[model samples]
Target: MPDDRVEVEEEPVSETRLSLTADCGSCFGLCCVALPFTASADFAINKEAGKPCRNLREDFGCGIHTQLRQKGFNGCTVYDCFGAGQHLSQGTFGGTDWRREPKSAQQMFEVFPVMRQLHELLWYLNEALTLAPAKPVHADLRELLARTEALTGGSAEELARLDVPGHRQQVNLLLLRTSELVRAQVPGKKRNRRGADLIGAKLRKAELRGADLRGAYLIAADLTGADLRDADLIGADLRDAQLAGADLTGAFFLTQPQVNAAKGDPSTRLPGRLTRPAHW
Candidate 1:
């Protein structure tokens, strides 16, 4: 029941100025090449790790970029790299591309996944620092943020050798504390459903304000018109969940990929930072 949702998807939400936002143009298609996918509901074909996706273009763009979902690549539409691609391409590897520098390809692929985890942590820590309810840990969060940010700047070899999970555990500790502080401010008793198996459960118009749904499986749940203000949704699987008319204002740690996987309409209120998914 742990928050494995963090590792399930990597793409950062678009339409945000957040440092973790994925700008594919600034990247070298690391996700397309460094990560593998299997033919499933999310992907259209089975690809081996470290192999470039056939849809990848010569300039590191997806040839089917505009039609990913249409082409059975639903995963590509929601998968985010948390800006790790650009950070590695332009900063860590100094614009050295895998295709151009065949020798560095394997090394770059190895370092990408590691760098991605670091950047994901950065995104969460940055979010924690912004919550006034979590102000008690602001100073500590800033320190952790600085440390994680510094890790992202390490050399490719250093990044490849990084103990990412160990570092993630260290970061998770403070994040847990931050979540407690923020949720404590809720008026009524907050529901503790961390990592609950609520897949396809009927939760229509549920009062889940300030709920702790971290890593919860909400797949296909009917959450229409639910009040989810100030909820912690880090790593929550929301695929095909009914969010029509749901209000998620002030929800923390909810990423774009989660939103993309859910079904919503114009009436579905989202946090200020997240835009309505194109498919919705």
Candidate 2:
């Protein structure tokens, strides 16, 4: 018989900064309105940009928050704006709601995506500074963080007109160097699967430690019990991947969206900033 011990519910170990995570209570339903989705394997229904989801409540909460997946809204769970929702709600917009100020709606919606990108970079740069092996690039990381943070705090017009891709390229260079320095410590042939299309491939229990899977398409792939320790997962597509018991310690740029999309067990060890999803 099982132990029958009452297991304490631990808050999922989150690897992201609090400011970078969605604060639904603080946000004003910007994500529900500003962004759009399409009917696909990822999203349940089609939604055009600049239009609010039909399920958005007057209080800016999802009507199906609890039954999102069961109600054919699984895609809602995978979408993450990297805390840009609250940042635009309370920070950039100064707590002024777009619904009340209809004129600001277009600008706020446009700038939200830009802010999301900026915050995402901030997350990466901030994580880069935490790696002891990446200490050599700490100064550069700080500079990049400062620049990205400034962009997040910019006015809607400034954010809408920002050269975000250019800035991201600069940050990516630093992240690439950081990946090299950190992966060197892990012994084995370092696998470079960057931007490779491996959709639905079977990779169960694979020796993937220190592998570079940046931008790789692992959609719905079986990665059960895989050893992803010290792997570079930056921009990797983990949507619907099976990560039950997979070790993702020190995985770079492994955001909540990717994690939420994947399946994992409570025993699965995560990086410092990653949060274990509840559906595991």
| Best TM-score among the predictions, by candidate number | 1
Candidate 1 lDDT over residue span 94-176, tens digit each? 98787788999999998989988888888888777667677778788888888888888889888988899899999999999
lDDT of 2 at 146: 79
Model 2 Cα lDDT, one tens digit per residue, 192-278 = 888989899899998888899999999989998999887889999888898988878767667888898888898777875667877
Instruction: Evaluate model 1: give its TM-score.
Output: 0.93
Global CA lDDT computed for model 2:
0.81
TM-score per prediction, in order, is 0.93, 0.91
For each candidate, the alpha-carbon lDDT, in order, equals 0.86, 0.81
Instruction: Please give the range of 10 consecutive residues that has the lowest summed lDDT in model 2.
Output: 1-10
By lDDT, who's the top model here?
1
